[model samples]
Target chain A: AQSVTQLDSQVPVFEEAPVELRCNYSSSVSVYLFWYVQYPNQGLQLLLKYLSGSTLVKGINGFEAEFNKSQTSFHLRKPSVHISDTAEYFCAVSDFLCGGTASKLTFGTGTRLQVTL
Target chain B: SAVISQKPSRDICQRGTSLTIQCQVDSQVTMMFWYRQQPGQSLTLIATANQGSEATYESGFVIDKFPISRPNLTFSTLTVSNMSPEDSSIYLCSASGPGGYTFGSGTRLTVV
Candidate 1:
């Protein structure tokens, strides 16, 4: 089984400022990590994912995340945030098992990023 | 990547009533899932809709309350049965593809 944790419930940042959203996870087996963004009254959008190979993964909207094995963390970061970046972010994990299992994902509680002007 | 179309986008239902949300994927997907996002809460997996079989539900959820059907690989439906005020939430459906999963717009259910 896999579980995800997003400690910060909300993060407030100014426009064009740098921001980072923390995420941690625990799993007995290897897993895949993902970051999703949800706008107000909308479904989640895929931002980035960490499957294998590189630990530092980049996604759309100038967002990136680094997967750290020792710390068990996959923190999302953006050098410069915009007002439109204000949304709820979620960190999720899915057990990939030995071969591959398009299995279910366990999501974090979510971090609401409030990017203001 | 698979594109999904889910509906009804939003609905207002009375207590004890039921509402069915549908998802249509552009391409066939290997796995399909249903999720619920409660007010001020995160997404919780309701069940995994299996093709031509019963859905595998998660803990704290049952088939009686949330009936699911996936007649094919590209179409699935989830029905919230015996609704109440507590059942008001956003319901989303997802389909897995090459890299990651794609989500529908989600159905905003308001149970009055």
Candidate 2:
């Protein structure tokens, strides 16, 4: 079984400010981690994923995440955020380690990042 | 990754009515899953649909309420039966490929 935890339900920040959205997962085995962003009235768009290589992974829209095995966490970060980056962010985990196939994803309750001027 | 096109983007239905949401994936996918997001809440898995087999539903969902069909690798439908106010939510379909999972735009359903 896999579960994800996102401690903050909402995070408010000013434009150009740095921000972090925390995510933690619990699984019996190693898993694949992902971060997705959903703009207002839109569907989910993949921001980044952690499969095998490095602990730090970068994504689109100037976002990045670090996978910390010891902490069971994959928290998303952005050095400087933009107003356009305001959206609902979700942290997800999958049991499948296969590179090309699909697996059921367990998602955390999303964190809404509100970036203002 | 595959792109999912889901329809009946938004609907308002009467109590006891049913609504079927359809999703067509651009590429063939082995498994497709359905999720529901109630207003002001995170999404919850409803079921997993596999080609040539009955859908595997989650703990709180049943076939009688949410019937799913995977006619082929590229398409599926999820029907919400006997909807009540509680059934009002956003429905989304997803499929994965080498790039990763992609979701449909989502169907926003309102039961009154």
Residue A70 miss distance in model 2 (angstroms): 1.2
True-structure RMSD for candidate 1: 1.5
* Per-residue alpha-carbon lDDT of candidate 1 for residues B1-112, written as tens digits (9 for 90 to 100): 7899999999999999999999999988768999999998999999998787899999999999999999998999999999999999999999877687789999999999
Candidate with the greatest DockQ versus the true structure: 2
Candidate 2 residues B1-112, lDDT tens each?
6778999899999999999999999888888999999887888999999999999999999999999999999999999999999998999998877666889999999999
Interface Cα RMSD per model, in Å?
2.9, 1.8
lDDT of 1: 0.93
**What is the DockQ (computed on Cα atoms) for candidate 1?**
0.57
Chain B TM-score for the candidates in order: 0.98, 0.98
Stretch of 10 with least lDDT, candidate 2 chain A: A95-104
For every candidate, C-alpha RMSD to the true structure in Å: 1.5, 1.1
Clashing pairs in 1: none
Error of 1 at A109 (Å): 0.5
